[model samples]
Target chain A: MNVKAMQKKWLELGVEVEETEYAKTGYDFSLTLPAEKVHALAEVMLADGFYLVFVTAVHALPAIEVVYQFALASSPRCRVMARTAVRADGTVPTISDIYQGANWHEREARDFYGVVFAGHPNLVPLILAEEDVDLKPLLKEEKNLKDISALRHLPAEAEPKEEKAPAAAKKEPAATDKKAAKPQASN
Target chain B: MNVDVIEDERQHQFVLNMGPQHPSTHGVLRVLLKMEGEYVLDPQPVLGYVHRCHEKIGEYKPARAFMPNTARMDYLGALIYNQGYAMLLERAAGIEVPRRAEYIRVITSELNRIQSHLLWYGAYLLDLGAFTPIMYAFDDREHILDTLEDICGSRLTYCYCRVGGVCKDIDDKFIERTRAFIERLRGRLPMYEKLVNGNIIVQKRMKSVGNYTPELCARYGVTGPLLRAAGVEYDLRKAEPYSVYSEFDFEVPTEQQGDAWAAFNVRYREIEQSLRIVEQALDKLPEGEVMEAKVPKKLRLPQGDYNCSVEAPRGELSYYLVSDGSDIPYRIKVRTPSYSNLSVVPEVCKGMMIADVVTSMGALDLVIPEIDR
Candidate 1:
């Protein structure tokens, strides 16, 4: 399978980024989406033979950024990061039913960041005790927020805007533009 | 001696707990076993016994300060963890690592893989009721550890890898000793084959004991030997080709049978392949500074996210770092391989004899600390 060609499909589906920042940063490809579309994206990725590497959440305050690392186990590596934001309800649709491996990763994300996966077979706390679930060990206070990219003395890439407060980066609902640009008969 | 009492006893279902207090389960792990007579119906793993707040520490400390802590996550394969975190920071920050530094990283990390496999072999045998092989395995492991001790000083949980390069250079003595150790172990390989692998008892016990198919591997997100044992030739060394791995020519050993026996053979063959990588690295050992120049004492990755993955001894050891433009990271997630490898227990270990559960778990070669972290 042509691993690189899959990005065009994702773009056609409307998850748009001009190109992955892998050469600039380390991630191969990053698709930032809302919680609702993530499960559908996972279904598409899984059908394409991509395996779920990890599911983790980065607390950027007000909202939590959930990152899913998926990789294809075929020739020509195609690694992509599927990210989405979640708020107070902390619920994202579960893909554990599709990929059995997501079962523990989703639980671990919940254990640390309290970003719950809706319809997860078992959403119990993992790697932490039951009482400590409310602590949400990974959430940092505002005063302690330090820009590690600056401290390390390295150049930073443009970050995707937090969904709750969006400004830069191409706006979503971008599928039609890419689709229209392609030959209409190809559909 | 009433027949009614016997009937009641026979029909009763029971639950057994294995080691939150520790033994046989590997590290401080606990398994909640549901059983019907002598057969296990389900095995639920309870983690967090050794959770040392690793992610919290990563966020609180500067990137360089957190180097030593990476070694703490997967103590058995500390160098791989060190390599993963260091590489993650380097990639995120666009730090250029020297060619020599990359070669050094590969050599040391491969050595770590062999040492890890040695212990896994011995421990697996021990789990299968053979105690003698461990003594023999450790005897060989001690030699490699001694050679590693000469370079980094610590025999285990090495804190030697830095962001752009290793913490220290490999001395001539360390190189000579490692070469000699490799030859010594190579000569001793057949003896191990005879003593452990060739033994009739081992073959009978391991073969067809716990079948994990390729489809099963995908569903469970199993990687490394477990995936390879099921005949999927996807070693990160070959597949992703990070660092200087692509430069090395080696075969990924795979097995058609997805059972404990296949895992045993794959891991054994992997040790030889690791030895080959060590040899190639030694021959091509370049002359240059070990540390990358202009690397600041403190490391702050740019305000973005980065992921670095290394094929650790057990499976993929991935580190994800999210920076908030501060000295401390916003979030740091350590994706240990054992967590996913061990998670398949409740599914596959179910409906097997309790003794076979031990066999299957041993085949997984899990380091409990890795899972807990």
Candidate 2:
């Protein structure tokens, strides 16, 4: 379907959409929806047999814009992007109910940008270490260092470090008394 | 000894740690399998041993710099990943590639598909307890690698394709060599059928095992040979033509049964179809500049989101790139086929023996790096 028909259908469904800008290279439509209607919009799209390609969040200054990209399975080329911005403080409704593929993508977004997806079954860290340490790797270098230090100041008891020998040390040969003496003799 | 054995027998299920290094697991994938006798009760796959955070690295690097890393994700189908990423950018930036460049892209991509299938054939035979087919398949794959290296200047991790077009042009000698190679491969395929495909041992191991119906295949988003094996006449090239594929004539091979044997047959038939595509692309190759002249040194795509899907050897590989009118992409999401294909393993392996899991996974052509990335 063309952009005009898509917008008209979306309007008929009681979902408000505004065409913010036109992109030359990719899909034509840039839609903005109310935060409360995000999940409903995704459900409607899913019922229409649209496939959820991915969910990504861009860190704008005042708000974190979470964009859910979809396309019809029959017409895979026609792309549609639905975006809704949550406050920088982080609160957004989850769409895992609508699309099963969104489960992992939501977890990834949460771990990286700290965007809390409400009602997500599992929001645990997908890639990062258990302890938070500047999860935003793309942040400015100086600010990242500051975030790292701030993370380091958390009470040690809050997050217990696993007690295991370092990987390199685990591979070291056992130090016998004879080997120690031989090392000294060589020196 | 009998008393001690009796005392220790509480009799739950044994947990077997398959590999961080086992050969059959393929590429450092470790699976914790809960076994009840010889059958798997449940299996949990643990990754990240080889994960270098490719997405994070791509985020830091410039758009052009990430082209080489595309090959690293699915080492077997490197050209498809390269094409998918490059095409997404090319479409976004509105860079027009010459006809000659598009033909070369098709030729190399088809060659890469053959190489990938050869590797899969070898690996699948190995999974079924035969070792000779692997050696035979590798011998054929070496020829493809040699041909690609001669033109692209690299063998395994080929960064040959560029944003608008391929990195280099092919000469008459390269074309002649590819034609000779295809002819040679056609002669050897009968030998492959005799040694592996027609063998009774392989048939016993693969036929009627790990059956995935067409409905289940669609539900799981399985594509490429696996979906075709399930009787779905869906190929991205024929369904939604891109990169001058519509110019070529080829058939989408499908099989009746979605069993391991059917998957193998679909891939085998696909190799023949790919050979036909390569021949057509070579004959119809337009003589012109290999790389487009108008493509920019620094690509700044307009602010928008683009999704591009290509038929990788394994399945349909999709790349979603969002640009904010900057040289660097705002968000890049790769929906690799292996992720969905691998997700269906626990379902397929539910009532099968431990050995069937290996064979089924091999037939599915599970590329762990692609999945983990």
Per-residue accuracy of model 1 over B1-373 as CA lDDT, tens digit each:
0011122365677899988864467888999997777777668999899988888887767876888888887888999888888888888777888888899999999999999999998888988889998998899999888888888879898988888898788888989889998998899899999898889989988887677887777767788898899898888888778899988889999999888899999999999999999999999988988888988766656666677877999887788887765567777888888888888888878777777778888899978888877
Worst 10 residues of 2 chain B by lDDT: B1-10
In model 2, pairs of residues that clash are: none
DockQ of each: 0.33, 0.11
lDDT of every model, 2 decimals: 0.78, 0.71
Q: Where does candidate 2 chain A have its weakest 10-residue lDDT segment?
A: A178-187
lDDT of 1 at B3: 12
Show how many residue pairs clash in every candidate, following the order shown: 14, 0
Worst 10 residues of 1 chain A by lDDT: A178-187
Highest DockQ among the candidates is held by which one? 1
